[model samples]
Target: MMWLAVGAGAALGAWLRWGLSVWLNPVSSWLPLGTWLANLGGGYLMGLAMGAVLAHPHWSAETRLFIMTGFLGGLTTFSTFSSEVLTHLLKGNWVAATGMILLHVCGSVMLTLLGFWQAQQWWGRA
Candidate 1:
């Protein structure tokens, strides 16, 4: 059942990631905006799920696996992000490549923190 949970969550996450990429990627020429966005969003969601788990320790392990390992595993696009950076570097777009690496890393971290904080607040935790 754990495998099923992960597979189902992954399928949904992958579809969502694909939809986001198709919808937003073409609007930018600097880098893969969709990939970056997915990473950041997935980070936030992972944080939120983690915070929820922390607040409610009684929750089942499978729920955590589904949201954290399964959903986030599929949603985050580290490979795509890396590939986009490499493409930029190959094309001599150093600034864009650097900017993307910095932005995605920093942005995902910030959003994760924000999501955790928000979840904590929602759960009435100090």
Candidate 2:
């Protein structure tokens, strides 16, 4: 069951990543918008789900496994992030490459924290 859940989640995540990449391919200019958006959104959603689960003690281990290990692990693409950064550097866009790295790292972290805080507040009142 766990393996099945993981497999399903991974497939879904890969599909989502591909879809987003295709959608953002056209407007890709200086920054790699697709990867940035994916990481930030994934981080936020993961934080929100984690916060909800932590706030609500009724959540099961299976739920955590599904969301954290399955969905989130599948959704976030650090490998792609690294590759994109390296591509930018290889293409001699050092400034843009550095900005991308900093923006994604800092923005994702901040957004994730914000999501967690928001979820905590929202779930705490429940």
Candidate 3:
């Protein structure tokens, strides 16, 4: 059952990643919108899930395993982020490369905090 959950979550994550890539392709030239969005969204969800699970001690370990290890691990594309940054640098787009790194790192962190706070407000109240 645990393995099944992991497999399902990973598959879902992969599909979501692919779908986002495809959907964002037309706007790929829009200064790293897709990757930034993906990273921020993933980070936020990760923070929310982590906070929710930790706050709820009764939540099953399988839930954490599936979300953190399977879904988030599969969904967050560090390699792609790195590649995109490198591509920008290699293409002599130093501004874009720097912006991408800073935006991804800082934006992800901020969004994650926002997610945790929202989750706290929502689940903590419950």
Which model scores highest in lDDT?
1
**1-126 in candidate 2: lDDT tens per residue?**
777777777777677777777788468776767767878888898879878987887987777777767777777788988888898899999998899889889999998998898898898733
Q: What is the Cα-based lDDT of residue 10 in candidate 3?
A: 83
Per-candidate RMSD, Å: 1.2, 1.8, 2.0
* Displacement of the residue 59 alpha carbon in candidate 3, Å: 1.3
> Estimated TM-score per prediction?
0.95, 0.90, 0.88
What is the overall TM-score of model 2 with all chains considered together?
0.90
Q: Output the lDDT of residue 79, model 3.
A: 89
Q: What is the C-alpha lDDT of each candidate?
A: 0.88, 0.80, 0.80
**Per-residue accuracy of model 1 over 7-102 as CA lDDT, tens digit each:** 888888888899889988998999677788899999898778878988998888788888888889999988889999999999999999999999
Q: Which ten residues in a row have the lowest lDDT in candidate 3?
A: 25-34
lDDT of 1: 0.88
- Candidate 3 vs. true structure, TM-score: 0.88
For candidate 3, what's the RMSD?
Answer: 2.0
